[model samples]
Target: MLAVAMLLTLGLGGPWSGAEKAEAAPAFAKGADISWVPGMEAQGYTWKDKNGNTRDIIDILKNDYQINSVRIRVFVNPSNDYGNGYMNKDRAATLAQRAKNAGMSIMLTLHYSDSWADPGKQTKPAAWQSYTFQQLMDAVWNHTRDVMYAMQAKGVTPDWVQIGNETNNGMLWEDGKASVNMKNYAWLVNTGNNAVKSVSSGTKTIVHLANGYDNALFVWNIGGLIANGATFDIIGMSLYPTASDWSTKVNQTITNANDMISRYGKQVMITEIGLDYNQATAAKSFVTDIKTKIRNIAGGNGLGVFYWEPQASPGYNGGYNKGAWQSNGRPTIALDGFIN
Candidate 1:
């Protein structure tokens, strides 16, 4: 309790005003995730050149685009040259501060791994490399409380939080993996829920599951948690156009998830969804179509759709994936379309 209290004191706290409820939005929320760094190299652009430059996702909302919010990922401790950013409570607090400074609501993603927490790489942070199960639970609670408090102190509390990224199989996977490997998956997930609940009194905590366009199997895996009384405030899922038309896929996706939400009386958020513009000429339209389909299915049902790293264009300087992305890779048009 002392730890959580001290952390919240550093920065974080708040319930958005009633008027701030996307109340003016005639439809559903259209949001994107973009963060500017002094130096960042993804696949193509360099960071030094784009240094001090800003890639404001909120610009879409403030400008002609109708975007209502932005999402940002925070790592426990990225083991890369991204130089210890958004990796800890302090960094997350910094990013959240900027988001609120832009007058935007935020969706916070907690990557349990030191770098990324996608299904393929959910390694626990170095500090917890050998932690016992109970120790890891302590780590999760301490970290969650610290970050939430930090954000509140800065007056940048996230509107929603993903307890762990695309955790389809479970997180910190040495023993949490679900598929034929970790028998403790459910317990691990519930432990994480308790961690989130400790600091989520005014925020909505989401359990995220990421899979290809057709993710019924994985979603069912987590749905079992809900059925078993695991607590969560949102049904969060990640969608990518891997096997079928994203639009058609998202349609079924929303319906399937909403069926669960309708049953549980919970809200939903398409926490991560996108089609790389570099993949095809139809990339732009592909993304726009998914956003529209999501909104159509969730219009009044109160669904939130957030594009994942849709703005990961080349930095003016070198970045992590420098050999791949282009400077103008972000689909500004696609973003404008979704929000509008």
Candidate 2:
């Protein structure tokens, strides 16, 4: 008893003693990608609480669902491809402003195109389609700088910024296609990262990829990035399980996340994740399990998980079945998993 008291007084204890350390552990962040909110609201979609009270979805998520971070996607010129642009630079700035006002951390995902830029189609913005590789690199740097600058001017610096969205096949196709030409891809990626740092030095950068459950794909994409000298702060992943196979996906994602930290010495985050809309109970379980797995990662490198477009109810444009809201504009039980 005397020895134990002395050890406690000196802030030293047996190997099993970590009471103070455990108490100091930071809270795990619960996040959601509400990139479609602006567009959906503009289209006359309204969200309500479980009590049928109209509410700003952002407020509800943060206040009720315990979401602390919000993710928004920014397109170079979405209006160029679709009428009435949404997710463009100006709109993104506005959304970021709102998020900041709501006291939530912001994550800006730059698609780097007029529309969607993903594995199947990483088409360059129509305006930059004719630029040479070198010019394309310049375009990337300039656009990133402009967006970051615009957001900063609004007194809102993103806590995290994704250089590209689901860049499995690479971004700015033909010029920066990872599978086709890793050198160019790395150059563009590094340029974007540099641009973000120059504009907002405090903002962390992320290299996003789809299908967090695929270890081989991560090895192919992220490994290549590291090989080609493409640096980033975090490895962001998208995990969307089909049917009820979330268990497998969650295990694979945790494995990939652990490998990413051990192999590359970087942090990991689930930038986008969703389950079938009808599977609210399963979604809750998946979120809970995934969050636990991430927090359990050996180091404190497992950042957090962000549900992809949880407020997008079915029947709304781009309202995927995996959304976490019900048809009545109220959150489903799936969102409850974020409550810590």
Off by over 4 Å in 2: 1-27, 80-85
> lDDT per residue, candidate 2, 162-195, as tens digits?
9999999899998898888997888788877766
Candidate 1 local lDDT, 23-142, one digit each (tens): 122235567665433123233333211233334434534454556677777777665655423346666667667756766777778887777688787888998899887677667767
For each candidate, the alpha-carbon lDDT, in order, equals: 0.59, 0.81
**In model 2, where is the ten-residue run with the lowest total lDDT?**
17-26
**lDDT of model 2 at residue 138?**
77
Error (Å) of candidate 2 at residue 228 is 1.0
Per-candidate total of colliding backbone pairs? 28, 0
In lDDT terms, how accurate is model 1? 0.59
After aligning candidate 1 to the native by TM-score, how far in Å is the CA of 257 from where it should be? 2.5
What is the model-wide C-alpha lDDT for candidate 2? 0.81
